[model samples]
Target: MASQAPSRVGKTLIALIKIGLYLFVLALVALVVAVSVAVSQLPSYQELVRRDDLGQMIRVRAADGSVIHSMGPSFGEWLSHDEIPAIMRDAMIAVEDRRFHYHPGVDPIGIARGIWVGWTRDDRVRGVSTIAQQLARNIFLTNDRSMGRKIREGILALALERRFSKEQVLELYLNRVYFGGGAYGIDAASRRFFGHSATELNAGQAAIIAGLVKAPSNYSPTADAEAARARANIVLQLMVREGAISEAQARAANPQQVEFVRTAERHNSARYFTDWVLPQLETLIDETVQPIDVWTTLDVGLQRAADEALNANAPSAQAQGALVSLDRDGAVRALVGGRDYVDSIYNRATQATRQPGSAFKLFVYLAALETGYTPTSTVVDEPVTINGWSPRNDNGRYQGPVSLRAALALSINTVAVRIAQDVGTRTVADMAQRFGITTRVDTNPSMALGTSEVRLIDLTRAYASVAQRGVAVVPYGIRRVTTADGTLLYQHRSDESRVLVAPWVAAQMTDLLQAAVMTGTGRAAQLGRPTAGKTGTTSSNKDGWFVGFSSGLTTGVWYGRDDNRALPGLAGGRAPARAFHQYMARAVANRPVENFEIEVALPDWQVEPDAESWYGAPDDYQLVDPDGNPIQPVEDGPPPPPQPREPGSATTEELNQEWLDHAIGRNRAPQAVPQERRGPPPDRGPPPRRQQQEVMPPLPGQRQSAPPVVRPTETPPPTIRPRAPGTAE
Candidate 1:
């Protein structure tokens, strides 16, 4: 019975052994099939060899090709195997894969370790990606974590090892990996961190650059100096252990002391310009396999100056600001979108659409100049109501006859509306659009006061046309675009037909604008040289602008609250003009002083008081004196008011003082009210005994009806003082 039991046990053991053998055979067959499938699906060798996705980077450079910034993936230039520094190669191999040279793109020991860890752990904590395997994954595969992906990566790695030399494989790995700061390869990483090519890298820099292969942003010196140095130390220690460098050499490396260059993009001032230029690139090149160099018209010096000026002055206005500077040919020199690039990147200079305020009056006045109206042509600066939109003068006062130059300098909204009504709003809008203002302007009377919304760049370009003697300007940032191999894709060519035949108008307008800067609202923009500009203050002080030009360049500055809230008391004469002055003073410091060309003046160019009558002012619109008497249209200033009083009372000054107590709060003087008029007793008399009354002087152009004086007893039905032109009030 014992012998029979032993036999039975032996049979059972033999059966179990046979089952295990069959299972092992089945598993081996599945593994072989998987490997075969992965190999068959390996990416084509041509795809690997023709890798040029790294060349799709767009590099934006100044006109002289000095790099301003770069965009897209793998912006660094590619390099060959021999060009890589020995120290750099050693550092990478020591830390990333010490058996790089010995392995056939897959290390058996590393694979075993990874498999054991992955099976026992909740998450795969080990990676056996060799340099060749990494290159395969980077170039041809996604970063998906799965058994299928791993098998494919391994197969591709093996194929790469068989197809290329170890040097070529390592070179591909080094040049294809991502480094921090938008750098892709060793060449770019070197230049990015050290401001020099990979060939110029030292042992310390090479170690730091190599350490980033593990995790670029995590150990980037620009992002985290401590983590980057600690990682570099690990690379150095590995190098020492691998015998690639002596212990003393590793200890003396001092990776922490590496002078990391500031590779952060410096497109602060040019952000708006670059953003505008990027879209324009599509017009020049549809597709390319290499980095395209875009030569832009940006002057870094001028850009720096503009940024500094805007930064220093913008905060004072409690608003964002945009400034665009263009050369005489409409080449954009500098553009600042807001106060700071870090706070916001909305590109206010190019993308923002805001009311230009009275700056648009330049177009209206320019249109008038085109139509035989000289700088001295008279226009009535009087109260005007158009379709329930009453525009008043800034001070709620009117001048019977103001020269076109003086009206513009004062930004008189009524005079601008009257002129637009006379010359036709469409004519002014057409002139504005013809000069480069692409914004749609309505033919409403308010459009004459800059109710139309336009971008700062487009408006500045329009002013550039005026500065350039009526030559139309297409404001452009890109000077030329070329491939890395210098194949020309686009180049700027000037066109002469853009010049207006009425060139004399620009010359005359320039004189008028110069008067504005020299003795008017833009006095803050004066540079002691011949300059011309206009100041614009919108309703509620929401937008303030100064668009001005020197013979060398024209600049437009806009200051406004981003939320459209009013910046009370802020005007173009204040912050905007100051910023313009500061920027222009520095921009043209080195250029030879120049002046606007003078066109021969006509006999009627001198201001005439009655000239405004030719514009068909309403017959009911009568000029009135401060005393509420009808005024004659005299060529000179209005005559002194008639003072009537009892004989031997007092001087005019004493009578004014005595009348202050009895003056009417509104309506008119008690005496000026006709005896036949019907109304309550005018409060022109002093308040009873202890009560003192105060009153404001009557507006010169306010028409009198009946006396309605305000007193302590009543509000006098609320006197309605007309709103100042362009004021929300």
Candidate 2:
């Protein structure tokens, strides 16, 4: 019975062993079938080789091909196996798969070892993928960690080894592998780390690049230089252990210094211009599959200068400043949106809209010139009220009468309003639109004083129009775009048109503005060459601008707080003008010196008003004495001798015709002025209140004097300017 029991136990053990063997065989067969099906669904080897579809970078280049900016996915230049350094390949093989050449794509021994390690350590940290297996997974599968995925990876690996040579597989692997920081392919990885081609990689650089295959971002030189060096040391040790490199070579290569290129994030000096270019990419290039290079009109030197100028002056205003420099052709040479682009990429130059203040007076004055109003035209500068709004000079004291040129140079608010009122506000707005002021402008009287908001670029373009002799300035940055292989994508065409202002008118406007810089509020922006522009300060100094241009470059600078908070004593002639001067100094340093095209006009300092008689008041309507001082007031009853105008021949009939024609049109001819008095006529209104007031203090940067008190018996009431929050008046 004992013998029979032993035989029965043996028989049972045998039967159990047989059953386990059959089940193992069945599971193995099922795995093979599943892997075969997955492999069949995989793309063919030829299809993978021929696939050119890859996300490439959109590189923005300066005129000299220097990289200004880059966007989109990274697909750097591909390198064949032969092109890749042997040291790099050997280091990669040693660190990733020790028995790469000996194995049939999937190493059973390696898998068993990995399994044993995982079982003993209770952590599946080790991977048993050969180079072929890694290539298969990288090319044909997602990074899934399931058993099914592992089986499919192994099957694909075997298929890859069967269909392609070992060199071919390695080449494909090196070309498509990700190496962190938007770098794909060994060439990109090499260039990104060493700033050179993979073929030229040294032993240390090669080892470091090869070590990134396991963890690219974790060991990137830019992100973690210490980790990258440690990884390279490990790769060197592994190479020695696998007999891929000699011990002496590994020892020498372990401590080798690696020089890494600057990270992409560090090269963001041109972010303001590049941000402007990002939206334009869609219009320039429809497809992003292929690599594209855009040649922009940006001059990097000028861009650097602009940035430095803005940064240096930012502390004064304690606010951000934006600058845009354009060539005579309206090509944007340099653009700096704010002090620091990385801190905030709002692109204030192109996007932010703020009131231009007196800078917008350019349009009003230009309109006046177009209507036969010379720069020497004179107008009363006394306090005026229009639509219940009273506008005062910056000094709170009017100059009584000043020339149009002097009014513009002095930034006389009342004079601009009077002119706009004379030639309908609508006409001023139309003239502004003709030049590149695209922002909405209210036709109110305040619009003449730059009450409307506008973009800095648009205002800069408007100034460029005057600088370019009345040519419509369309500010553009992109010059041309082409593929990496020279496929033409886009080229800018000249769409410039003639603005409403004639050349002579624009030249006169330029001459008037030049006087502004030479002696007016923009004296701070004076360049040795002929330069012209206007200064602007919004209410409460919320926005300060210096939009001026040399014969070669037109630049507009805006200094203000992001939240529209007022800056105390911040005027366009201060920080913004200084910055404009600094930037323009550099922008035109190399260019030829060109004076503005002006017809030897009268000097800005010359002041001679037409001296003549007026309506019934007196024969002489003298405001300023021969010495240019306001005449003192007299007693109440006796009328003082009339003040004579400055030296100029005055025509009685022609001078009186204007007031009489206007009075006839309005049916309110002043009965005070004698009908027979053949002389210059006074405005229709009662005498002003006789009150002695001293000259008030000037604005931050200005000089002024008290005006002569005119007691007209028949003069129209002057219109007053409206006051808004933050207004200088």
> Across residues 1-729, which tens digit of lDDT does each residue of candidate 2 receive?
778999999999999999999999998898677666755776765666433444667888986779877676456566777778888889888888878888878899999999999988987846799989988887767898898888788888887776677888888888777887677888878777778788887778888888888898798887898899999998888888888888888777764467677766643558889888768878766866677888999998889899899888774645988999989888999998888767787889999988889999999888777654566556668765565566677877778767778899989888887777666688889998888787898887788888899999999998898888777888888888888789898889866555545565687798889989999999999888888888998888888999998867899999999998888878988989999999999888888888888653322111221112111235445444344555433445743445655578532232233433443343344454332121111231111211223232222222245344222112332343344523452
Report lDDT (CA) for all predictions: 0.75, 0.76
RMSD of each: 17.6, 14.3
Q: Model 2: which ten-residue window has the lowest total lDDT?
A: 606-615
Model 1: CA > 4 A from native: 1-51, 75-77, 120-125, 265-267, 315-317, 387-389, 600-729
Candidate 1 residues 1-729, lDDT tens each?
A: 878998999999999999999999997787567556656775554454445755577889986678787787544556678888899889889888889989988888888888789889865747788888888888878999887888778877877777678998888888778888778888878877788889888878889988998898899877897888888888898899999999888878988788888755544767767877889877777766766789999998888899888878774546898999988777889988987777788888998988888888888888776654556556555555554457766678876667777877777777777667656678889988888788888776677888888999888888888887777777788888888779888888867456652455677788888888888888999998999998888888888899999866999999998899888778888889999999999999999999688463332221221233233335666655346665444455654565686798733432232233333223344455332111111222211321333231222333443222211121111222322344321
- lDDT score, candidate 1: 0.75
TM-score of each: 0.76, 0.78
In each prediction, how many residue pairs overlap at the backbone (N, C-alpha, C within less than 3 A)?
A: 2, 22
* Winning model by lDDT: 2
